[model samples]
Target: MIDNRDPLSRLKAALQVIDSQRKILSDSKSDEMLVRDLSAIVRYLNSMSISQASHILEKAHRRGHDQKKNQAEDFTQAYNLNLDDIQSIIDSENVTRGELESIAVGRFQVPKGSLRSIGNMEQLKMKVSTLVQNERSHQTISKLAGDHKYK
Candidate 1:
């Protein structure tokens, strides 16, 4: 139960618990502890005012999103699809510009007009190959940065 008499104080107390748990998990480098602490934080935040929780939550979400996007881009690069070949395939398949994104990601939910724009199975396979290359490149970069202090 939140103490309405001193809501700010209650929030601060919850924040203190979260901060301490985070410190402990970080220092010990324990994934299990980190997960537990993160769950606890989420639970605590659920009762808090949106204005109070938005700042930290947004920052965390943005960082995670950027990391995922970078990983995807790296995968695309590793697929080794030359620009010319990729463009040619897209042109030859009459791929819709909007649906092109879906096809690139192996998600083909093409609508009526876009249905005829899909390339042959072979061409789709080539696009898949390219996507994998980008993913692999991203993984390599992530590994290097995390494990080797590489730029």
Candidate 2:
């Protein structure tokens, strides 16, 4: 139960009123009703004290930020993905890297510029090919040396 005199209670009641007005506007069949409902909501908001309005806005902003952080943390914990890994997947899939990076930094809270140095898919493929060739050469030399020693 909330006391009617409490700031939080008043804010909650105001939000509920606004929400009801929105519902009425959505269901309204006439332009006049729509305009009236919208004007009422606007007037109610305008009449609210500056301090109360600011407090509500601040709480809403903080709540949204906390939700994003929590969601990002949960995703990382479940999928074991870091920014580099995500970038690699995005590159491999041939998707837009910039958009994905923006989402990663803005919504997922990944540190900005973390994947700036990650090479493209083509570069990664070339590096893998070079490593494979070097490994093959090393194995061939080792096999030849062993054969000669056994002769």
Candidate 3:
């Protein structure tokens, strides 16, 4: 329950919880802790129940994870690259426009549609280099090996 009896204060309190909850939800591992967080964010008498929110959001997160997993699987299947080779391309800054585009639009879903940068090698290299620096690149590299699936 909101500590404040005033209507405006109560709304402000809920807003504060919602703001904090947004950050937690984004980073949460979808564990039991999420239930506690939601319970705190929304008091059952005031708004949506914790159970309903948890079920919906957890399902959405699960679907998103599955989608990313499928996309990564398909990308690695097509590329079949060893980690050393993948790293070499990233380090060389000489990766092809097609390869960069594949990773960007196909795997990372960086703004769908044909990027004008894809036609320009220098631009493509810069974009892909940025991508390589991201955690997604590291995760994708870990998926390849000497192997085809993600760990």
Candidate 4:
């Protein structure tokens, strides 16, 4: 005899089985691991509901779109730069506005001059310092010699 029972009773029986499985898995796992896994499962189950899942996905998509828009907005534009602004920085600092403008405008190429004068300038500075020291030494020697001659 095929007897038709309540459909809700069948759902309840399935739920009980799932609950037992969840408890068994939780019991086997460490407390921390159990909490993490259970939390993930709960989140996934909640998302399975059509409205909740759509809402989460919609929020995520909106966030991603906004992030890309913000990134695009952050990009530097050539039109935003001013020649006076570059010149002001140069006047206030050791760097020149022309050099800054050249750097800013990729098309404006500057030739790298030879550093040959750098070594020469460094040698000249060292020579000047040495000459000054030598002059002082000579003065001291001359004074000592004069004092000995007088004694």
Using TM-score as the measure, the top candidate is: 2
Quantify all predictions' global Cα lDDT against the true fold: 0.59, 0.60, 0.60, 0.47
lDDT of 3 by residue, 1-151 (tens): 5544344445556556775765576567556666566656555424645555455556766999998897677566535654445446656755666566556665446764657636677777667557656745677677675376456
Clash number for each model: 11, 0, 0, 0
lDDT of 2 by residue, 37-125 (tens): 77787667767885877687678779999977875665455245544454454557564545454444543555656656556745544
TM-score, model 3 to reference: 0.30
* Model 4 CA lDDT for position 79: 27
Model 3 / residue 101 / CA error / Å: 0.7
Task: Return the number of clashes found in candidate 2.
Answer: 0
Off by over 4 Å in 1: 1-49, 81-151
Where does candidate 2 clash, by residue pair? none
**TM, every model:** 0.25, 0.35, 0.30, 0.29
Q: What is candidate 1's lDDT per residue for 13-47, written digit by digit as tens?
A: 67777777776777787797666768677577756
Tens-place lDDT per residue, model 4, 27-85, is 78757676567657654554355455455556766999997675334323322434445
Q: State which candidate, 1 or 4, has the greater TM-score.
A: 4
